[model samples]
Target: MVTLDWTATEIALSLGISPVGCAEISGYKTWVNVANEGLADAVDVGRRQQPSLEAIRKLQPDLILTSRYRHASIARALGEIAPVHLIDDQENEDDMLASVYQSAHQAGAALSRSDDVARLLESFDGEIEKLRTGHAGQVEGRKLVVAQPLPGVPRLRAFAPNAAISGLLRKIGFADGSQMSAQPFGFATVDLEGLASLENDSTLFILGEAIPDDLLHASLWPMLPIVAQGNVRLTGIPSWPFGSTASLKHLARQIVTRFV
Candidate 1:
C-alpha cells in the first residue's frame, strides 16, 4: 500500500509490513535518519505537499492511506490512481490515545492484520503498565510541560491537555504543568515569559531540538525553576506526536529512560 500519513507508515512498520512507497521519505531527519533505519527499501513518492502522481502510477498500490489533517486536499486526485483511505484524526478530538487506537484498527482492517494490531495494542498496554508501576512514586505528584520551539519564531508551542503528547505524559502520571488554558486544537504559543509561570516542581520535556544556545544566556532563562533545578529533559526520538500505539510506546520508553 501507499502511505501519505507518517503515523500510518509507523503503524504498518510496527506490524512488520513494509509499504511500497511513502511521501517525504528522504526529507525528515527523524523519519529518515532514525525511524527508517531498518526499512530502507520504500520508494520516495515525493514531498508531502506535492506528491508525484507519476511516481505513484509506477507502483500501482492496492490502496492509498492519507491523513485527513494533512492529505485531505489531495484525496480526490489520488483516488484516480487507487482507492484512498482517510484516517480521520478529528473523530475523537478529546482523547488522543483512543484516536490512535481507532486509527490502528482501521489500518489493521485495511491491511488484513487485525490480529497483529491487537497484539501490538496489548504490548503497548503492558509496557505502559510496567512504567506506571515502576515509576509510581517518582511521577505521582510530578508535573510536566511538553514544548517544541517553532522554527524561526521566538515562541514555543506548548502542548496542552488536549494534545496527544500531553495525554501520553498524563498516562505516565505527570500532571499538566502549563499555566495557560487548554485550546481546542491542543496547542498554545508561549514566549519565555509565559513559560516562567509554571510551578516550581514542574519539569519541562523539550522536543525536536535542544534549547537554543542563545536562549541559555537570556536573563529570563535561569529564572525558571525547571531550568534552575535541571529538570528539563529532551526526547531525542524523531517520532510523530499524532501516532499509533507504537509511537506511544516509543515515547513512553523515552520518558522512562530519561526520568525513571
Candidate 2:
C-alpha cells in the first residue's frame, strides 16, 4: 500500500494493511496520534511536497495509492517504483460515495473487515436520515462552521468550503455557509476578533487532536460567541483530518451525530 496523507495511512492501518513505506506533510506526528501497528515500523519517507525518491525506491512497495487532490507529483514519483493509484475526492453525495467504494475496490483483500466497512457505511446512512428527522423540530436547519485551534501558529484555522468537515456537512444536508471555497483540503486563518465578527450559527465542528486546554480555555477562545454559547463541537481527530473512504464515513457520522 502507498499513502500520501495521515488519513490514508490511518485508513490503511484500520484496514489491516500496511505500506511498505509512505510520506506526508512535515511534522505529521505533531498533529496526528500515530497508531500502534505497522506504523511503528513504517518509515517516514519524506514530506508530502517532497518525498525522498531514494527512500521510496528502497521500500519498493507493490502498489501506491494517494488522494488525487493532495499530492499528484508524489503519486507520479511513487509510480516509477510501483503501480500508483490516485483516489479522487468528490463534492456531491453520489460522487463522494463512488470515491469511497472505488477505494475499497483498490484495497483488494488488505481490508481485514469488509463486513465492518459495510456496516459502518450503513450505520452512517441510517444515522444521517434519523438525525435529519430527529433534529428537524429543534435545529431550524442550521449550518456548521467548522474550526480548529491553531497551535503555535498565531491564527485560527477554519475549514475551507471543500475540506473534510465541509464535505461531510454538505453530505448531511447542512446549509453550506461556506465563505472559503477554493480548496478541497485547506485552512484559512482568523483572529479572535475576526471570529467574533462572523455570524453563521448552524454548528461548529472543531477538528484536531485532543488538546483541550489549549483549545478550550485559551484566552483567545473564551471570548468567542460560538464557544461561550456552546455552539462549537470540538472533535478530537487527527491532523490530516481524513482517512480511507470507509473510515471517513465513520468520521462523517460522528461529526453529524455530535454537531448536526
Candidate 3:
C-alpha cells in the first residue's frame, strides 16, 4: 500500500484511488471534506509541512508519494525509507500537466489501477476544450482583482503569470492589477480608501485558505462595496485559489458558463 502526502492524496482522490494511509494537512480537515470522510480509516501521517516520520514508518507503505511544492526536501528524506516521488510544480501548464498525468499513472501503478488515470484525463479533455472555445471572445481584455485573505497577515497574494489562478485568469482574458502582481494585500484592511488608488473598472476575485468570520459576521460585509457589487469571486480550491490542473479545468468551465 502507498502512503500519500496531501498533494498526492488530493490527486489520488481525484483519480479515484484511495491510499492505505495519508498525511493530514491543514487544508484537508477543512477543505477536502469528502476525501477526509471517505478515508477516515486511513492513518494520518501528520501535517503536510511536518509529517511524522515515526508514524509514517509504522504504516510500512510500499511507496511514499508526497508533493514537491512545500516538501521537496522532505520527499528526499522519505526516499530513504521507501521509493519517493518528489514532483516539481515549478513548471508551466504543460509541465504541470505532465506531472499530473505521470503522478496519476504512478499512483495507479502503486495501487495497480493504471487505467483509471487515463480514463479520468480523457473524460476531462472535452470539457476543458469547450470552456476555452466558449470563453474565447467573451472575457477578452477584462480587468480582475485577485485578492488573498489572511486574518493577521499584512499581505495578500494576487494572480501571477505562472500561478495556477493566473493561468485560468489569462485564459479568461482577465488582467490583474499591476500592484496585485507586485504585492499582495488584505481585503479587510484595503477598503475603498485603498481601492480608490486603483482603476475603477477592476473586477474583484477573492482567494484564500479561509477568510475570517469577522468579514461576514461584522459590519464589514456591507462596508466592502466591491464584494457588495457582486464582483467578488471565491475560489473553492485552497492552494493558489485554483491550485491543481483538475481545478484549473473547473475554473475554465465556470468562466465560460458564468463569468463570460
Candidate 4:
C-alpha cells in the first residue's frame, strides 16, 4: 500500500501497515508526529500536490490512498499505477469525532483491516470516557480556546468548534470558546484584538513549541483578560491540529497529563 495523505498515513501506521511509499514524508514526521517508525523504510513519492509519477509508478503498490481534496485532479493518473482510494479530508459535519471514525473505517476497509480499525476506535472511545470521567469536575462545560500563535507575528490560527482538535477537547468535557464561526478547515486566522473578544472566563490554550517573545510583549497581550487572569496555557509540545484517530489519542493523553 502507498499513501499520499498524511491522515491516511497515520491510519495505516496505527493499523500496523507500513506503506511502501508516501508523499511529504518529512512533513508528516514534523507535523503529525506519530507512528513514524512505520515510515522509516517507506519511499518518498514526492510533494503532495505534485507527486513524482515516475517514483510512484516504480513502487507499483496494490493500493494507493490519498485525500480527495489534494488528489482529485490526479485520480485518473494515480489509478494507472494502483487502485486508488480517495479519503475525504474535510470535516463536513457537525460531529468531527464521527468524521474521524468514518475516515478511519474507510481507510481500514481499504486496507482490509476492519477488525483492527474497530478495536482502535473502541480503545479511543474508552480513553475519551476515562478522561471525561476523570476531569469532569474541573473541565466539564468549561469554555476553552485553542490556538497557535504564528511565530514572529501578532496573528494566530484559532481552532473553531468544528476542528478535529476542538472536537476531541469537547469529548473530554470542554466547550469550544473560539468566537470565530465554524470554518471549513476548522480554524481561522485572527489577530490579538480578535482573540480579546472571547469571554473573560474562557481558558486559552496556546499550541506551539515556544511562545514568541514579541507576542508576550505586545501592547495588547497583557490587556487580554485570559492572560491577566492567568487562564492562558502554553502547550510547548509540538502538535498537528489536523490528524487521525491515533494522533488524536496521542494529543488527548498529552492534554490530560499536561493541560488538564
Relative to the true structure, candidate 3 reaches a TM of 0.69
Judging by TM-score, tell me the better candidate of 3 and 4: 4
Q: Rate residue 59 of model 1 by lDDT.
A: 94
What value of lDDT does candidate 1 attain over all alpha carbons? Answer: 0.75
lDDT of 1 by residue, 84-172 (tens): 88876556667666777788888888888999999988888788888888898878668888777677655677878878777777887
Model 2: per-residue Cα lDDT over 1-260, one tens digit each: 55666655655665567676768533545454445455656777887666677887787777766666666755666778887766554423323444555555444433445676666456656765665666655443566666767776535677665555555556566765446554534556766666676564645666655534655555877777776777767566653344544355545556665643
> Which residue pairs show backbone clashes in model 3?
156-184, 156-185
lDDT per residue, candidate 4, 1-260, as tens digits? Answer: 89998988999998888999999999999888888999999999999888998999999899999788889999999999899998776746455666788888888888888999999999989988999998788788888888877877888888888888888898898887866677868888878888789899888777766666867888999998888898877676777777888777777666666655
Error of 1 at 196 (Å): 1.4
Q: How many pairs of residues in model 3 come into backbone collision?
A: 2
Models sorted by TM-score, best on top = 4, 1, 3, 2
* Residue pairs clashing, model 2: 24-48, 143-202
Model 3: per-residue lDDT, tens digit, 129-214? 56656676766676766666656543344444444555456655566543533222112245444544445566665554345464
Candidate 1 residue-wise lDDT at 173:
80
Q: Please name the candidate that would achieve the greatest lDDT relative to the true structure.
A: 4
Over the full model, what C-alpha lDDT does candidate 3 score relative to the true structure?
Answer: 0.57
Q: Which rank order by lDDT, best down to worst?
A: 4, 1, 2, 3
